[model samples]
Target: MAETAAQFPEVQGGGSLIVAWQVKGKTVLVVGGGEVAAGRILHCLNADALVTVVSPAARLNPEVAYRVAQGQVAHVDRNFEPSDLDGADMVLVAVDDPAASTAIWQLCKARRIPANIADVPPECDFYFGSVHRDGPLQIMVSTNGKGPRLASMIRKFIAKQLPSDAGRAIETVGQLRVRLRQIAPRPEEGPKRMAWMSKVSEAYPWDEMCGLSEEDIGNLLRFYPSGKVPALDELKAMRANPGADKEAFDGSFGFSVGA
Candidate 1:
């Protein structure tokens, strides 16, 4: 008999899977008004979620009150009710009463909704990791709710190691991708377009990529047909003299990947 292939369990490791959930324009119900709840509210706002806070007016802390006053978030000046979960896409529980929080979590689970009970790993469907944000770039460090402070420290260290222009590079590359799609609109051209873009990304340094202007992007598009990665100096020359003859670029310029 032939040896059987090894079978594996669904969860080989015991940790929460980190994901960037797009909550934009979705309803997020936050059931509390303390500091923890304030933090949760801010996170929801940052993702452009439609947020509603359910807590008594007297319970709201300064941060939450300020947001409510500014019309940044809708507020229900009362204790959380079952109806609060009616149209909530997601729920966050940060009440002082652990029992209340757990009950809310159970209610969400019964309704097939995701919920995060602050500091309760078992009840939480998701944990907010320490995130470092730079323009369009986001770096998150998580420790499965084991060591949040340590995760924050690690996030800071990682952020420090990255180039200051890293975010700008990502933004520039994103725009380049849009341009590339326009130049090669056919579905069959995807593989070749991806290969060319990959080559261009690997060839240029972050700062140089960030410096790329409209003319530089046009120069890059010219080489997309041949799938050639252009030399850095040629791009620099084009920027230096924008009025220079385009026909002069023979597409024979020597290319070198930046160190």
Candidate 2:
């Protein structure tokens, strides 16, 4: 299955590169420096993973190493050790330690821990992909560990489709959604009990939060009748009307429908 997929129809490049990374609170070991290590660190931070970066020498990115010194990250100086995998869930052996990293790779494979060994193809369990972030959303693009440059170029393509302001609006609504569910009368069925919830998305006005207070969400909820919440499709439409070409509607969540 794995061998054929490597050479199969879409897995080569043109397919939807899909993967679910189990990263929340998982321990990640990153070794090495320069741009590669910085990129990996940022990716890990996005996942909220517990990352421990090991490096012998320091670089210009003091904030990178600062996180380690401040105990936000665990750093190991000098060489890579076999026991480094003591409690690691994911390992990234990045650097010029081909021999040492290959040894670490063998150890990870022995323990069934997923690991990526930089520079050595055979020693890797997986590889890093290009990534994009739209506020709370994260998208990763990979070429099955083959083409990094192409992956980056694909990221640019993704950037064009996503609205620059979409993330902020979504995040603002998400926070309100959480709070709204808690105070809602039929809390368990909050989604089904709010008629205007979807329309609210069409005009969330994240930038004009200058005019909103915590009271606005409460007042809005009070106006909603019982057992009449909005559906996701409606909310999506209110965000970017699904009825048409699915572009942002004039009365979309970003603009006040009454405005």
In candidate 1, what are the lDDT values of residues 120-225, reduced to their tens digit? Answer: 8889888898888888888989987788999999998878776655687788899899998998999998899878888987898665575567778888788889
| Model 2 steric clash pairs | 192-229, 193-228, 193-229, 194-228, 194-229, 201-253, 202-252, 202-253, 203-253, 204-253
Off by over 4 Å in 2: 1-17, 58-72, 183-223, 226-259
- What TM-score goes with each of the models? 0.83, 0.65
lDDT of each: 0.84, 0.66
What is the TM-score (0 to 1) of candidate 2?
Answer: 0.65
Candidate number achieving the greatest TM-score relative to the actual structure: 1
- For residue 86, give model 2's deviation from the true position in Å: 0.6
C-alpha root-mean-square deviation, each candidate: 6.2, 8.5
Among these predictions, the greatest lDDT belongs to 1
Q: What is the lDDT of candidate 1?
A: 0.84
Q: Which ten residues in a row have the lowest lDDT in candidate 1?
A: 250-259
lDDT of 1 at 34: 95
Residue pairs in steric clash, candidate 1?
none
